[model samples]
Target: MAQFLNKLIPTALAIGTGISLIDSSIYNVDGGQRAVIFDRIAGVKEKVVGEGTHFIIPWLQKPFIFDVRSTPKNIKSETGSKDLQTVNISLRVLFKPEIDKLPWIYSKLGMDYDERVLPSVGNEVLKSVVAQYDAGELITQREAVSREIREALTKRSKEFNLLLDDVSITHLSFSQDFTTAIESKQVAQQEAERSKYIVLKNEQEKKAAIIRAEGESEAAKLIIQAMASGPGFIELRRIEASKEIAETLAKSGKVTYMPNTGNVLMNMNASGK
Candidate 1:
């Protein structure tokens, strides 16, 4: 039992030492990661490597990893419009560190580059763009404003070895009072439009009525002139009316009966000659 114990102890110690050595010497860089090498004696080195396994003298040099994949950052900023109204803006930026300049970025800005730089630069560009337009234009021309901000950020981000994938203005808002004012203006405009429509409709109706009245008056004049041009029209109408009355009386069976005398007599009462 003593002999077995001595051999097993050495074997176990060897296995543990081997594992420790492997753990220190080997390092893996994941996909989409950028790693920079730093030496204990010489300080940070310019050598930068991308994804996969990497080797360096253990305890002499070390690796710092950075994700070069596209990442989104949110920025909430408050600025003023051209009309001096306070505008609150929410924005998103898709960005990544330049792979080739990973070492350079580490040397200058360190790992906190995103926190230190992107917000200030974005806010500056945002304020400048907002200052160029009024509050109303900001809503109407949002796409234009976003495009301008992108162009400006691109130019500035390159200086810091940051590649900007995209810049988007996600939200634009005004104070409660301003929003209420806008709503009131819209309502007033709608009301004015309705009033104008009603006035036009009433005018149209009045014009139509006048046209009908004039048409009736003209027709009456034409009829009177036609009747006047017919000669003996009144007398002809009277004779036709009498004949119609006689026919009506005969048909009614209420015609009066009267005795007819052969000769006319001037009567001398009670005496005949």
Candidate 2:
């Protein structure tokens, strides 16, 4: 019974070792991952694996897992504009590995593909794009800039086995002096506009005053012509003025009259005389 148990132990250990080896050789690739297989004899193979259980020759062969999902990377760069102004740029990029090119990507660029490709390519593309625009244009037309960057990246990314999902220019800024100059220029423009409004208002008022004076002159001329046309118009106007004076004086609870010779007409003996 002891001899039989000893033989069974050796067999069980051998079977357990084989099971462990098989488990180690098998790679359970998740949904978001892709794999590249390497063999000692044939070197890195062209066949890549998707989301499934894959087997590799242990010790002689290995598997490298690469995340194939959309990933975000933040980067920054500085460059000079066409106007020779210093500009700083911050970027956020969405990217992922191309599924069909996984083997070539792994073999050529390896897992640190982003580190090797994105910085240099992004730098070159950004600098080239920025060189076309001035500092002001960069701020105002940043969407164009971002679009240009993506376009350039789209073309360039193909070289590095990557698909550029998107690129965002999160923030863009300039020097303090430039900002201050812009503010000062805006303030000066506002002051100039205010001055123009004031000048316009003064001119309008002057014109109105001249128009009123001309109107008064024309009205006086018309009145003079009407008086000349009617012989009794002057006398009638004088009589109207005298009547108005008389009415005003009667309302004051007192009465007085003067003749054309300027003698006052009143009852002298009303109180004592």
Candidate 3:
């Protein structure tokens, strides 16, 4: 019975040791790369699980994990315009280390890349570009500002082995007095334009009235000249006018008086005889 118990104890001990080895031999994935570090044992690459795990190393190389995801850096600065007015600008930058150049990034800029590089580049780009524009231009040309900033940052980031995804202007602030003055000037200019239109419209109406008057005067002169042309023409026109009057009276079922010039002529002839 003692011999049997001793064999069972050894078997149990061996099983427990195997279980411990299995637990500690997991693989660790770093920086989204398949590159992994082993914990204590070697040749454990086959045991790697999805994306991340603990692994056994031969105690020679140490592992450092870097985040492979896109990171954001927010920066703010005060820049002077060409007009020498200080404007407060805030920007948010999205960037990440170039995967292919990660080794150079790690070597040159180190882990505090965001802290050291982002602010300096953002400020330099913003201030340099803004200094070329006046306060009014800066307010009106937001897209230009964004483009210049993006280009400047992209160029600067290349040296640091960074990939610039986007640079966004989050906020801009100018003096209240400057804003009010600009608005007031715009309003005055609009009012002047409206007044000029009104004056032009009035002039057009005056010219149209004068043309109508001139047309009416010319028509009256033509009618007077036609009437004075001859008595026969006048009598013919009177007869036509009388016929039109008779037609109108007939439609209304009314009688109109007609002068008898033939009777008057007969009486005059009998008197002469």
Candidate 4:
């Protein structure tokens, strides 16, 4: 029984060792991932591996995985504008590794290539592009500025074997003093507009007053001519005035109108109350 047990134990141990070796030798490069092999003796192999189960010699070789998928990164930069004003800027970059250069990327920059290259290159491009424009242009010509940065950054990234899918300016800000100056300028503009409106209104009112005075003078002249011609206009005006007075009394509800007799009877009862 002891002899049988010893033989069985060696066989089981060998089987377990074989299983572990096979497991370690096999690896799956998932979708959106690529890999490069690192040989114990040869350092890093030049050949790149694609997504699938791939084999490497156990204990003598290792696989370094890289995500070939596009990833987003935010970069912030503070630099001086062309006008020497300090500005804070933010950028959003979508980046990935160049699939064909995976081995070189792993050999040189390793897993965090984006982290190392993007910030430095991004800041350099941002400062360069921003320095070319005044602080106002950064806001006014924002698209042009972003395009310039994108072009520069894309070119710079390619030199490092990194691929940038998209680059955009996300945020921009200036010093508090500059912001306050802008607000003050806006307020001044509003005040100037208000002043202009007031001047226009006063001029219109003055013209209206002049027109009214001219109309009153013309009416007085017409009245003089009518009076010189005959007394009919004066009599007509008196009748119109009397009619208006009667209507006012009637609307007060304290007088009874006698239309044919041309008389108004006051409500003595209302007057007593």
Specify the highest-TM-score model's number: 4
Ranking by TM-score: 4, 1, 2, 3
lDDT for residue 42 in candidate 3, whole number 0-100: 41
Model 4 root mean square deviation, Cα atoms: 3.2
lDDT value, candidate 3, whole model: 0.74
| TM-score winner, 1 or 2 | 1
What is candidate 4's lDDT per residue for 1-273, written digit by digit as tens?
999999999999999999999999999999999899999999999888989999999989999999889999999999999999999999999999899998888878878888889999999998999999998899899999999999999999999988899998889999999999989999999999999999999999999999999999999999999999998999999999988987787787557756576564677567699
Total clashing residue pairs per candidate? Answer: 0, 0, 14, 0
Q: List the global CA lDDT of all models.
A: 0.87, 0.87, 0.74, 0.92
RMSD (CA, Å), candidate 2 to true, equals 8.6
Best by lDDT: 4
Worst 10 residues of 4 by lDDT: 257-266
In model 3, the Cα lDDT at residue 143 comes to: 92
Which scores higher on TM-score, 3 or 4? 4
Q: Name every residue pair that clashes in candidate 2.
A: none
User: Candidate 1 versus the native: TM-score?
Assistant: 0.78
Greater-lDDT candidate between 3 and 4: 4
Task: Indicate the worst ten consecutive residues by lDDT in candidate 3.
Answer: 41-50
Q: Rank the candidates by lDDT, best first.
A: 4, 1, 2, 3
